[model samples]
Target: MDQYAQLLAALTEAGALGEEWRGAFERAPRSAFVPDGIWVEDSDAPSGYRLLSKAVDPVGWWAEVDSGRQVVTQLDDGRTDGPGVATSSGSMPSLVASMLRHLDATDGSTVLDIGTGTGWTAALLCRRLGDGAVTTVEVDPAVAAAAGVRLAELGLEPHRVVGDGLLGHPAGGPYDRIHSTAAVQRVPLPWIEQTRPGGVIVTPWGTPYANAGLLRLEVGERGRQSHGRFVGDVSFMWMRAQRPHAVTAPDRPPDHRGPSPLDPDLAEENVHAAFAIGLRVPGVRTLHTWQAADPSGTHRFRLSDDAGSWASVRFHDWDGADAVHQSGPRRLWDEVVAARRAWLEDGRPELTRFGLTVTATGDQHLWLDDPGNALS
Candidate 1:
């Protein structure tokens, strides 16, 4: 089989791509959407990414494009000589297919595609539902223009808009389906307003502590409210506006020091526990690291709010109890311990069992099992 066909077959076997989206995937090959210059992760590189040019290394470029991994298209929001943080990427093919499948769009379904990225997603939507049925919005003008060019190359022209996706392009709505490639801390009210009543909105929703959950919300009658569950796990670039502020350690020494009541590793190692804790504890970021010079082989787990609060726990090989240090107004370590206790008391539910409800006014309530059982 050809490379594209092989990919399709693999995705089909993996259950990421369904037969319904096969034609669309076939029509819009990922290679056509990928740029000539892309960044790949490198451990030794100072900025953690090494740029590869198609002109200089066509074979390597093709390999990366064809691979299952996401292709980083822009770094530091298009800053050439800036720190190599990946700001935009062509999402992993399996993830793209899986999200499209969950979208469950049908013939004549009008879609508002948020975060155009490489335009590959818009192309796929256009192929499935026709060009007129797709309207894609991108925050970055340069990214939008480049994606538009790629879409044109594929003979696909979805109404392209250059603006913040949070304020969705209302002119294209009330759309039947709203799909966002970017992750959001909270579902935008504009998205809810633009989607027709009974329509669906599929996007990655998560907290600052853990950014992994594919949320699928079904709009309520009259478009006043929506309810949905985290159908799957997905990690996507945060919507530029909603991206969490950098988590920096407080300059001063820690104020409180004691033995941790709970193992810090539990919060870092368990995904469900992490998700649950993130829901209960707001505005906290978790980090795990080890001291290179520590002779005792200590593992450090740190928590920060990017405000003035910070916490650190050190786990040594011979530990009676891990040492905990907290500073600032918020006792982050204590909050995490309490959140984890709550999760366990609630029967340690998986992330998928949790769901979200949002009203027209953007009041969000997270619940367990049913919408009525709202989390405090």
Candidate 2:
């Protein structure tokens, strides 16, 4: 069997590709959406990614396209010279299929697809829902134009839009289903507003602690609020606008702070603990830098946000005390420790046990087990 056939067969066998979307997947091949010159993320390389071209290596390129891996089509928002941060790509087939399966859009239902990357998702939706039933919006103009061309070539015409994905395309309004291909910090108010009452909105939800969780919300009759549990773990690129603004730690003074109450090793070993920590600590991004030269296996966990707040915790080992440094209005490292303590006190809840409630006014209340008990 060909690569596409093999992938489809595998996905079907794995139950990732539902029967509802099986014919659409076969009819609209993923290859049509992927560009010739694409980049794949490789940690082995110093630059983090290596470019692959259909012209240079058709066999390899074809293999990647048909494979389940994500194919990066753009880097650094189209500014980088080589192998920079991946800005966009054709998402993994299994992930796409699984999300679509979760979407569970029925016939005659009008759907809105956010982040039309490669337009593959839109194409599949068009094949399933028919022309004019699907509307897709992309943030980047160049990406939108490229996807439009590909969709046109495939004879699929979904209302292609070029604008912020967070702000759902209201022109396509009152959609029965709203699906975002990108990850978001919170459920956008515009999505809830644009979705019809009782409609479904599915998106990859990320917290400050970690880039994970697939949120499946059912729009209420009023369309002003929605609540849903995280269906599964998902890691997708942030919505372009929701992406973190440029923030870096400035030079710190030669002052020593108290040791962090939280254990870095505990957070590192437990994904759920880390995720819970992130949920409690809002607007901060965490990064850990390992010390290669240090014989004691030391590492520094840096926390910073767009608000000019920054903190760093350096630890030589899990058992010993770690040095903490802060040089901002907000004591981020302290906040993380407090949150971690709270999480531990709460018995270290799993990601599935958590839920989110979004108001039309943009208030996102993260709750534990029940919406009534909001996490503070």
Candidate 3:
């Protein structure tokens, strides 16, 4: 079988691609949306990825497009000419399908798609909901224009505009459904404002502690507040405006305190552990690095906040003591331990058990099982 057919068959069998969206997948070929020149990540490479070009190798280009892997179309918001780091691209087919499935948009539903990217998601929505029913907003002008051209070539034209997705395209709404292709630290107020009462908003929501999940919120009748549970785990690039402000790593002075009584490896890399920690310790980001000082290359997790506060936990030996150091007003490690203790008390709840509530005034409250019992 051909690559396209094989992909369709595999997705259908695996249940990632449902019949509801199969028509869009068939009508709008993925190859049509991909750029001729793109970057493909290589795990072993120091630079992390090598650029692929249709001009250089057509066969290899088609292979990667059909391989169902994310092709980086632009880097550093199109400022970096080469493959420095991926800023945006056409998302993998399976993940796109999965998110669409969860979105549950249907005929007659007016939709607003955030972060147009390659415009594939908007095209898919347009195919399903019709042209006038879909409106897509992209932040990068160059990316939006390129996507608009491709979409027009396919006879698909949804309201493709260039603007900050965080502000949302208010002219499009109050839409019946709002879907964002990017991840957010917090749900924006405009989205809630533009969505009709009882409408749904779907996007990948992340925490500073190091976990992200799909958030599906239903705007209340008043349209000021929305509450919903986390559907599942999802990883997406952050919205440009909401992206964390870069802060310098805090120094580990020689006069730092003793080793932590807690084992860093105990809950170091676990997703649920990170999620739990994020609820209690807000406004902190983690970066895991492998120190060469330890031959085993055990990870050293660094915690930092926008306030220049930072801490590091080096797991050199799994069976022995791990080094812990902090130089901040807020004791981040202590917060992590306390959060973990709370998680243990709550029977070690997974991310699925947690939910979020966004007030009309825009305060997000993280809850476990019951919305009334919100975490600070």
TM-scores, one per candidate: 0.96, 0.93, 0.92
Q: Which regions of candidate 2 fall more than 4 Å away from where they truly are?
A: 42-46, 81-83, 254-256, 295-298, 318-322
Query: In the order shown, what is each candidate's alpha-carbon RMSD?
Result: 1.7, 2.2, 2.3
Weakest 10 consecutive residues, lDDT, candidate 2?
Answer: 247-256
The sequence of per-residue lDDT tens digits that candidate 2 reaches over residues 1-376 is: 9988999999999989988999999999999999999987778876688888999999989988988888888888887565387889898889889888888899999999999989999999999999789999998999999999999998999998899888888877999999999999978888888888888899999876688888888887673668888888788988987886544545666244667666666654576787888898888887777668973565777778768678877766443443777767788877888888889899988888888988868788889899998998
- Candidate 3 lDDT, 1-376, residue by residue in tens: 8797789889999999999899999888788888999888878765587778999998999898888787788777776455366789888888888888878888899999999999899999988889999999998988999899999999998987899899988877889999999989999988999988988999988876754788888888774568888887777888988876554566656235456656776555477777777778888887777658763565776777878577777666433443777776777776787888888889888888889999988889989887898875
Query: In candidate 3, what residue range of length 10 has the lowest lDDT sum?
Result: 314-323
Worst 10 residues of 1 by lDDT: 313-322
Model 2, C-alpha of 241: deviation from truth (Å): 0.9
Tens-place lDDT per residue, model 1, 150-205, is 99988998999999999999887899999999999999998899988889999999
Off by over 4 Å in 3: 43-46, 81-83, 252-256, 290-299, 317-322
Superior by TM-score: candidate 1 or candidate 3: 1
Error of 2 at 96 (Å): 0.8
Candidate 1 clash pair list:
none
